[model samples]
Target chain A: MDRRTPVDDRTGRRIVPETARRADRPPTRYGSRPTMKDVAARAGVGLKTVSRVVNGEPGVTPDTERRVQEAIEALGFRRNDSARVLRKGRTASIGLILEDLADPFYGPLSRAVEEVARAHGALLINGSSAEDPEREQELALALCARRVDGLVVIPAGDDHRYLEPEIKAGVATVFVDRPAGHIDADVVLSDNFGGARDGVAHLIAHGHRRIGFIGDMPRIHTAAERLRGYRAAMEDAGIPVEDSWMSLGATDPERVRRAAEAMLSGPAPVTAVFSANNRVTVTVIRVLAEQPRRIALVGFDDIELADLLQPGVTVVAQDAAALGRTAAERLFRRLDGALVAPERIELPTRLITRGSGELPPAG
Target chain B: MDRRTPVDDRTGRRIVPETARRADRPPTRYGSRPTMKDVAARAGVGLKTVSRVVNGEPGVTPDTERRVQEAIEALGFRRNDSARVLRKGRTASIGLILEDLADPFYGPLSRAVEEVARAHGALLINGSSAEDPEREQELALALCARRVDGLVVIPAGDDHRYLEPEIKAGVATVFVDRPAGHIDADVVLSDNFGGARDGVAHLIAHGHRRIGFIGDMPRIHTAAERLRGYRAAMEDAGIPVEDSWMSLGATDPERVRRAAEAMLSGPAPVTAVFSANNRVTVTVIRVLAEQPRRIALVGFDDIELADLLQPGVTVVAQDAAALGRTAAERLFRRLDGALVAPERIELPTRLITRGSGELPPAG
Candidate 1:
């Protein structure tokens, strides 16, 4: 006789425990829990038949499958697949190493990655590197030790040679936003250089030769690319770039505010300014709103209320969600047997002209 | 002979593959990869000694440990803990199931949970339920199969008895932002009732008796609480709410705009509005900005660029990050051997009175 009591759905109550009700209940050697072996024995079937039924393989006869299914239901058994996964040497999951999750830029990126993972029937394991190289390496190594199928990294550091062995050990990796240093790998990047150049060129075309630039730390790849674009635009137009007109350091609001004020109040005050990245753009807009100058400004990266601001701000807009989606799609394709060599994909950015970028230089 | 290669700091190169001589080399099998056993054999030490060195566990003689460590470094051996974790029945990771990850509210909440998890030396595995109950159950069950140490769920489903077995097996679980149905579990909730009541009372004090309530789906727990608070405030003011003054459904922008227009245009237009959530508040603000009537509004949650708009948005603000942090801390505490029954934690929400909430009814 079967020892399990079936549960009724209507009343939402569990039947009494069989062992608790009777002191003479037989002591099961494998404890109170039921296993597949017990289900097979109860169904009077071979162990392989039960396994085939559980895995939904095609070899089982219909009558035998029904009996195994009934036994499984009666025994309340669930397959323990962790052991099987360990033997197969693959976990249908990938790691996403990104910057701060709370930042608006990364939020959409994470969502995009999650959608791709879901569609591919893979789970995502993610961690924020917090822009720290040591933390990034630690998180990456930990994910590798868990035997994830692949990795999608928005690198916080320039160097990632620590991943060489793991990559050579058959873990596919793709870098996003920036290239890995001292390594050759697939990369997806936004056209930061072209976007910045066009934004600066737009400011210059609006009759502003003296354009100040406020950006992130110089060590950052994107920041350096944007700075180079600014210099190239000024040189192409034969406009002398001043030392005081450039601020390449931290992205804090106070620092950005100081940079904007210094350029606006210098001996040869700039008639326009170009802000790099969203955080710097927001701070620069606030500073410009406070100043008396009718400065023409163009920022790289769009913000939420840029359209609603007084004299709406113009910007060079990069589709952050698209960047993430494209990167994630490439990652899954690689996992799906596309063993092609490493490729670099770049998505173009658009220049959105509102009022600020079109402002005429004050005499 | 030792095959170890020193790490190159300048170029960040570690070891060059033997495939450098050939343009293309096929990946090796899993067994061909170096293991702890191989390292121990190469170093002339026992497997346990190698494990001690790899796990940084103590109780090894200094010279012997150094030899094992050097062997590990030389062999490019990374410890595989999959088998060990399977035997131990814990992944040292927690699963965070949330609604929409891209939503500004949930982004900070996720980051807070991650911070708490990191502090406890645990990794986080997260997925978006996309506000679908089936998806929620699927994601939750998948996490359970992975044997996560605990779960932090922002529930999308009204029923969650599917998690009973996992909980019975001693997995710690905590629900945040909403309560799980048909289950007894720890929960963390914001003061939705109190916040909505205070916001409505503030509008009433401003001489706006005909208040409109725009809420989320009526079935949601927090939405119901906020709606109840609106009714309580109306009763306290001795004002009978008309049927047209309440809009309860999805918080989509088009739906909310139509609802806001219906309340403002028809006979007996409301003088003030109480938005139940952030998405509703945003849509309502856009509609109100278009109308000439001076309608007062107090939204349930704070949003970015609120202060920058004309007549800065007033809000009944709940600290989403704090809610996530508190819940995650409690979960980790439970994992650390805290044997206590499930408890309910309520965090307070604050009201910020900007210009909108203070606007009197149009004469």
Candidate 2:
């Protein structure tokens, strides 16, 4: 028997734990909600007859159908969709695993996926991985266990061998914002490298060779890609990037603050800054605002009220909604039995020149 | 009969639709996954014997267990959790319905609910109602049909009597950001009225007799309460309010822009503006920035990088995460069998004075 939980430790109440709730009490299904078995008993008919009537299948006489319907109303017997789903073989639900729901960047992406799922007549269930690999796997598998028909993942880990079994078992999955490691799967991504390179190059074009780069941890695929872009932009300009100008680590306010401060204080400080992502850019904006001289800055992602700021923030904008919509559309296509090999779809990014990016280096 | 879908219209290929996938193949449980009967046949045992081993019940011999395990591995059969959930009274999942997922204000709130749900080992599935009553009802009922253990609702509709049957059937629910209509359900809210009154009063203290109130539609509870607070503040100061000074409707940029423009233009224009929410605040900031004379502004909800602006935004800040965490905790407590009456919990909002709200009236 499953580990029987007779009471909740926190409340010390006799509560039926999730695992044992229905297993312990087999008489009534779903806590006093009458089952088809109950409907059959009340209707004085066989279980099959009740099932047929409930499912609206033929061969149930009018009198039998009336009896079943009456029993259903009397007993408040709403057909358990769990049983219906079990019989149907599909849950009509899809799972979305994202980095963090609280991140404004992901909010649009998640919503886009949900809209697509809704259009396809599938409910979307999502979880935030908090950018942890183990948590990502746990959440993904749990969603799979619930038997969601498909998955849209923003992978935290490089290795996804754990999903192999589930994939083989016919769970269609698509990765977004990042690609899956050690797995051949459909991936939807923004042109992170190109976008970042263009953003950095734009700053360089504005007469700044010593431009600082503040980015997320290099382990993250987007971070690594963006960092590469920053280097390539400098290399193309014949400006050898100095070690002090590159800060690649955590995007927390404290760390980014220290990084910005350290870079600005050196004997030869960077005159401009390339913020790799939104979180990093917000902190950098705060740091730059207190400075005696304005520092030219460019951010990778667009933020709300960016245009309304004193010097509007310039950004290499990627469409988060487009990324999500593409991935979900592809997932549905796969589910529609389109026999196509896994492929990567990269969406283009645009650079919007707001006042900040156009500012010349302050002496 | 459940609609027999022989082919997918989009792909023009044979497909197993959500409803009939398992009903068409009773021998198989989930899309070619082996059933207990398959295992029993391979292990030379009865169906009940196979089930006993699978469910970890007593009286299964070690030899039989080994044989069943081998058959399971041979067929690559994983137990269908949909069926497991059917046998288990609880699905171990909760549903969250919010106004919009892409809104910055809701991101932290949703994350908070997810965190609490995680603590209780329940996965949260949420949908954006887009503030539409019909959509809210559809999503809530669908979640109910899926048998989610509880629901955390940020109600979009005034009438939630539709949830009566589901709530009575033992689906624990808690309303957040708003209250349930016609039903006395547990609700967690920010002190909208008191916060708004204090915000408007702050402008009054700063020597602005002509204050303007821009808010959401009065039909919304928070919006109406905030408007009431604005009126009370003006009345306390013995200043007769003009009809033209108030704009209460949609918070979209276009509408908010028009509203802000209208309020600032007329004879005896208001010297200060009180923005009701985050979205409204953002739009108003833009309008105020473009003005030749600085307009004192107080907004509700602290926004990102608010302090970095030329005149940092002063806001009546509500803790969104606290609201969500509190509501989720109550939901889990109800699930834990807390036999308490549905109560309203009000969290206090804070007044953060940066620079904008402190500005004196322009000459």
Candidate 3:
């Protein structure tokens, strides 16, 4: 019973059913393609000679290899990797599950992971969960069914108990930007709590007692941690927070714009603001630009053109590339046989104060 | 005789050698994993019963299924998809190769492609060529080796004759952003030439004759087309172009900064500038903001927070998401048996006038 055997010894049937057999496969997709047999026939050679040439296996003579290459070109024969993957028992690929691929924050992160995977001679399969728990589970399990050598997940779902079987069955797994819930796993995250506290404290030190906190929903772990840091900083300064000054919900432009405007229009408008993330910060910058008085601001994530703005946006910048690289490195380490217990690693954040966070409360 | 058979009839050996056999596999990576046979033995059931239970196949009694599930949990057995993919002809995955994954311009495009792939029940494997032609060819062929059902390529390479065999073997392919070279394939591109011409014409209409063009290397198709547009607009205005007014090379910040400064300085310098791409535009904005005298500017490709800038950036905007979606749709259509000859598609670009592109020439 070699692990590579496709058929069960007792049943004489494939371990998995052949529901998508070649005969049943859609003709438009797989049909009308040349096979190794066709190449061999065209070259007047054995199938082994064709396979050796195609795989670069090095047994065929130069003449035979040339003929096979010419035959392959003439008939357009491609070695079927599905069967090769089955024989090899390793796909040399990994899966990355993230929240959104379009977010600027994720661009560098995904690229970093890709670089690391490439270094390890593996390709990356990326899927977006769209922040849905059900979708997250489906994508994760689907990648598992693809038998990726490893997985790096930015957990959109809290309870990842569904991945227990996969992890236990030897798929290397690493969680990035968030921790896996209800499971012990390797995790790499930024100091979301500490970074938020520092950003809020920067505003506090700037002589602003009243500040608004705009962030994502509190149910999200990073959002919750950031909100807690804001509160902690406020408490440390002996400044009471008002319900009117706190707006936590979706980070969509319209919602953030309304929240910022509402906080600014009140009789006791906030003198400063602490934005939790890049998207929220961008919207907040727009709202503040239209204001007659200067409102101090600090954001959690670094944005593309933040430094070039009028009053350059101050931020608690997390190294997105570093987070991705670290998680991917850990994943490859696990695949290379690191048998350590699952542990959490948090990278520190840097606060860059250009002008906005240092602005004084307008009289 | 079956395509799914791992062994060769003539040689009595695996077509692809078992180079990475279980015994030769890294002990820490795959050796510790439990197997389906272990689960069967633990549950006192046959291997077929375990397979049925794992795959959710019917004909197993509820009591027996429960037993198999429990054994699966206890033994940490996960179904191997490599074997399954071998039995079925399709891997249900696609590949995307782009210049750089970290570029903001590509983020939305990749996301749009992913959404289409999701709708079609296919996963996307992404690789970054980092603007290298060799790497682009390598990544493309590797995806072919992995048997991706289709490919969406924003090619960094011009010579794509390497992909001819794969395409002929029935792997659907669609080129985006740039057209393929030396190969016939479906292509989706933006109207770079028309868009740049319109943008420059708008600048000329604003009463500026000495307009500078800062762009990427002319080797890139889009850059060359944009440069052609600039020339057309200058010719249309009957303004003799100055050789000193054009800078074409890498779009790095340092290079662009030097180019913009040189164009703005010296006797009888350009009164306005047309940036060829987003990266160049961003650098140009920074340069223009620092100038004591105002310099009207138009840039290609819109940037995030452009509207919020002091003098909002303006330019010809190509729909990146639409490019990706159209390319992906075309690839799937080819896979669905569209026997139409390879065609080229050019999507229209929009001219957005914010503020930077509408300024008067400074004295």
Share of native interface contacts present in candidate 2: 0.45
Task: Kindly list the per-residue Cα lDDT of model 1 for residues A1-363, writing each as its tens digit.
Answer: 012534335522223321221344233332134567899999999888898998889988899999999998766566655665688887888899998888888888889988988999889999999999899999999998888888999998989889878877777788888877767677877778878988999998989998999999888888998898899889889998989999999898999998899999956799899999999988888788777878888999888767767778899998878778878888888877674567666667789988999999976
Interface RMSD of 1: 12.3
Query: Isolated chain A: TM-score per model?
Result: 0.86, 0.86, 0.86
Interface RMSD of each: 12.3, 13.2, 18.8
Local distance difference test values of all predictions, in order: 0.84, 0.87, 0.86
lDDT of 3 by residue, A233-332 (tens): 9999999999989999999999999999999996889999999999999999999999999999999999988888989999999999988998899898
Give the lowest summed-lDDT range of ten residues in model 1 chain A.
A12-21
Best by lDDT: 2
DockQ-superior candidate, 1 or 2: 1
> Between 1 and 3, whose lDDT is larger?
3
lDDT of 3 by residue, B40-146 (tens): 99999998888889889999999999999999877666677677766776778899999998999999999999999999999999999999999998898889878
The alpha-carbon root-mean-square deviation between model 2 and the true structure, to one decimal in Å, is 9.2
The recovered share of true contacts, given per candidate in order, is: 0.35, 0.45, 0.51
Model 2 C-alpha lDDT per residue in residues B201-291, reported as the tens digit of each score: 9999999999999999998999998998899888888999999999999989999999999989866788999999999999999999889
How much is the lDDT of residue A330 in candidate 3?
Answer: 84
